[model samples]
Target chain A: MRGAVLHAPGDVRVEQLEDPRVVEPTDAVVRASATCVCGSDLWPYRGINEVTEPTPIGHEYCGIVEEVGSDVTTVRPGQFVIVPFIASDGTCAHCRAGYQSACAHRVGVTGAQAELLRVPHADGTLVATPEVPSAELLPSLLTLSDVMATGWFAAVAAGVQPGMTVAVVGDGAVGLLGVLSAAQLGAERIIAMSRHEPRQRLATGFGATDIVTERGDEGVARIRDLTDGVGADAVLECVGTGESMDQAIRSTRPGGGVGFVGVPHGVEITGRQLFSTMVRLHGGPAPVRRFLPDLIDRVWSGTIDPGRVFDLTLPLDQAAEGYRAMDERRAVKALLTP
Target chain B: MRGAVLHAPGDVRVEQLEDPRVVEPTDAVVRASATCVCGSDLWPYRGINEVTEPTPIGHEYCGIVEEVGSDVTTVRPGQFVIVPFIASDGTCAHCRAGYQSACAHRVGVTGAQAELLRVPHADGTLVATPEVPSAELLPSLLTLSDVMATGWFAAVAAGVQPGMTVAVVGDGAVGLLGVLSAAQLGAERIIAMSRHEPRQRLATGFGATDIVTERGDEGVARIRDLTDGVGADAVLECVGTGESMDQAIRSTRPGGGVGFVGVPHGVEITGRQLFSTMVRLHGGPAPVRRFLPDLIDRVWSGTIDPGRVFDLTLPLDQAAEGYRAMDERRAVKALLTP
Candidate 1:
């Protein structure tokens, strides 16, 4: 199988790798139909995070089950499925509470940008739709596995409500989808803080009522101006950096919520600001599995077409180009068909 | 009029000051029957916070309304009332949402440790009982104005559930009452992290099922041990220090909530840890006005006696001693009879 592997910081390659098989009782071998480069992959590619050894590269995918372990009951061979970014046992206390991302017996399914992948806890982690999605809907359905679910988590965490104003602090795929999610959640107003023309246009199409082309203090000021001097009722921090975090905090109302979905890089929230400002903060690895079914339904019903985020597409053998395109900001999201 | 004034750090003196009068159309002058020292007051008294001049120092009080401004409609003259520490116009959007502390027309009502104090937005800031209660209930009712309500906010924010394990981080009146609040909220297991004998007893009396004497990492480990290494389902952070915040965060289960009512001092939250751990943080200056009616009813019916926190009582002239005792940790809370 061909997979994208990170040998070190700034070094990514598409190479031949051993095929994955169902080694665990709850595992399923998936023949990936579609995979994509994620924003998180840039962490190590940009040399911000250390890559000590060659490591598997993607975590988002939609695939067909080639084989299933004996313990996998819900999904079987020949089924088309969307694998949530996180694997869960489905029976743990946290999983029962609908926080499958923090499942007690959870494991990460790596090397998703490959021809084939092994998914653990298949019964809990994979959701199968009644019909196989066409290639035209593949990218949109693929997004349900990670980015869409993450955006939904940010909206839910921030408690976006009808007639409320929501601000998204990142211009990446998740942030763009966050705007869409907030709109879907009935937010009266959506403010997208982005300077990039392509992202700004996508944000507008994704239900952003207002666009602020500023960053940090100026961005917060712009949001406040649009909100009549009061900050947004809900803010999604989709860029995990000091500036982005500060903008998120400052852009939220005193008692409003800041849902941070971006994998934090150098961001820090001081206790003084957190308590004094009284903004509620909730985030982490999103419980993507909990939201997969509904998101898949939305995609299937054509209510939301998250696939528009993928401005570039390539074959599995060209995974390195997908990474490079996203890294260079030439594409918002890149889809790879295996 | 005589009031308790902070001339410098560690210097609280009962001194003569101008008598308070209705300064606005919505103001009301109240003749305080009682007031108290708060844990937050010690922040400035301990020299950690800069005190520039002789600042009027109390924010909690219960008193008789001596006069009302022309615009004050709900509260009239000669009515007994409990004034929330923050005076807010009940008409504001935030106030309507039960976040009166962040009300648009907010007024700080300190200098309550005096014979008379002017309360702004009297119609919305003061909650009146049927009539003046017995002297025995005065202290308990007075606590509802701040500390008690703050504790209740912590519990509510932490989302305490029946049969769930909870941890209260702080031994002050607020933290002790947090244990009581958690119990009232139906948490089956309450852990009060404290080393102070008096506070520990108070915590036990308030329904703490366990006590952890350690702080920070050790404290978190102890909480986890008590909960079978899963950590408490919710943690109430009543102390604003970085250490207390960290302990509260570490002691809660992944996806659990940390309701922090503590006025954050220097605590900081790293984005990486927050995202990986998946904790929800909620807090701020409690909307005491929102809970006053119910709490006052509870106190009036003898269901709760939060007055137990005030171990010492003194005349208004001896406000200095009350401050001294609380500053030295000799008293959890102090009551001053005017």
Candidate 2:
């Protein structure tokens, strides 16, 4: 099997590796049809998060199950499925509460960039589609593994509802999809804060009613100016940086909510700041498994096209190029085909 | 008029001051029937929050309107009213949305321990009672001005729902009332975190089903052990400190919420900590004005008895002793009367 491995900061390589197999009864070996470079992957690539060893990378994946452990009941060989970024036991208290990402017995699915990946908690973490679809639907289905579901969680966590004014901070794939999620949730107005032309256009295409080409305090000011000085009703914070988080909080109304899906990086919030803003804060590693079923349905029904975020596509052998493209901002997201 | 003035930290004096009058068209002068010292007052009295000069203090009062400016329509002379701690114009976006504490035209009410208080935005800040009540109801009604409403806000912010497991941190007047508010909101199991026997009794009387006598990590462990390790569904943070905030966050389930109403004092939260908790956080100064009408009705109807929190009483001239008692934890709360 060929998998992408991180040797050091800014160094990712696709090389021959041992193939995965179902070692546990609750595990499943997935032959990944497609995988992608996630924004979180850039954390170590940029040296912000440490890369101590040559670690297998990639967590987003959707494919056909090649084999399953004896205990796996919901998914079987030949079934098309989406594997959540994190595996969760469905019966755990947190998983029962729809927070599968925080499940008591959880496992991180790594090395999905490989030809075959082993996903644990098969019945609880794998959601199979209703039969295999055409080649084109694969990209959209793949996003449900992480990015799309994460965007949906951001909107849901922010309490986005019909007739709400929403602001999204960040221009990444997740942020773009957040605009789409807010639209699906019936947000009355969507403001996308992006400085890049390409991401801004995608934001508009995905249902952003307005765009503010600003960052930091200026971005907050622009959002406030657009919302009649009342700030947004709900804000989706897709970038997990301190500046983006601050902007998201300040851009929301007193009773508004900020659903932050960005993995935090150096973001420090003082009690007084959060208290004074009076904005509701909720965010974390999204429980992507919880939304997989519905998201698969939406993708199958052609109700949403989240796959458009894949602006760059590469063969598994060019995995290094995929990482380079996304890291250099040459592509919104790089999708890799097995 | 006799008023309480803080000349320095720990130095509260009862001194003769100029009589208050309706200064603005939206102002009303109320002759206080009762006033009380608050936990927040101890911030400056204990020198945690700096006190710069001789300033009139006290923000909780229930009184009879002695006079009203021409613009004051909702409240009139001779009517008994509960003045919210912060006066607000009811028409602002935040106010109309039920976050009066964050109202654009908000005015902090001070000098309430005096014979008369000049309340701004009278029409929006004062909730008139159906009629003047006996002296016994004064204590409870006065609580609506601040403490009681703050507790209610904490519960509301935490989104207390029927049959949910709830926890209240801080056994002060607000935390105790939070227990009562949670009960009124139909929480099935209420855990009151307290070490003091007196406050524990008050908390239990206010509807706490369990008591945790630990603090910090031990307190979090106790709460987890009590809830089958699932944590509470909703937690009311009545004390604003780094320790209390951390405990409240850690004591909630992944999908749970923390409603914090404590005035923050040197509390800083790292993004990594909050992000990992996966708990919703909502809180601030209580929009007491928004809850005034409902809280007053609850007090008036004998549905709640928040007044029991005032364990000590003193004449207006003994304001200094009232502050000292509350500051030294000799009293849970102190009632001041003319």
Candidate 1, lDDT over the whole model: 0.90
Q: RMSD of candidate 1 to the true fold?
A: 1.7
CAPRI quality of model 2: high
The worst-scoring run of ten residues by lDDT in candidate 1 chain B lies at: B223-232
For every model shown, what is its TM-score relative to the native structure? 0.97, 0.99
- How does candidate 2 fare on TM-score? 0.99
Residue pairs in clash, model 1: A271-B267
Best by TM-score: 2
Query: How far does residue A287 in candidate 2 sit from its true spot (Å)?
Result: 0.5
Give Cα distance to truth, residue A189, candidate 1, Å: 1.6
Kindly list the per-residue Cα lDDT of model 1 for residues A1-338, writing each as its tens digit: 99999998777899999999889999999898899999999989888888888998999988889999998899989999998888999988788878899898999877899999999999988999888778788989999889999999999999899999999999999999999999999999999989999999999999999999988778888998998777899999998888898889999988899999998888888887887677889998899988988898898899999999999999888888888899999999999988
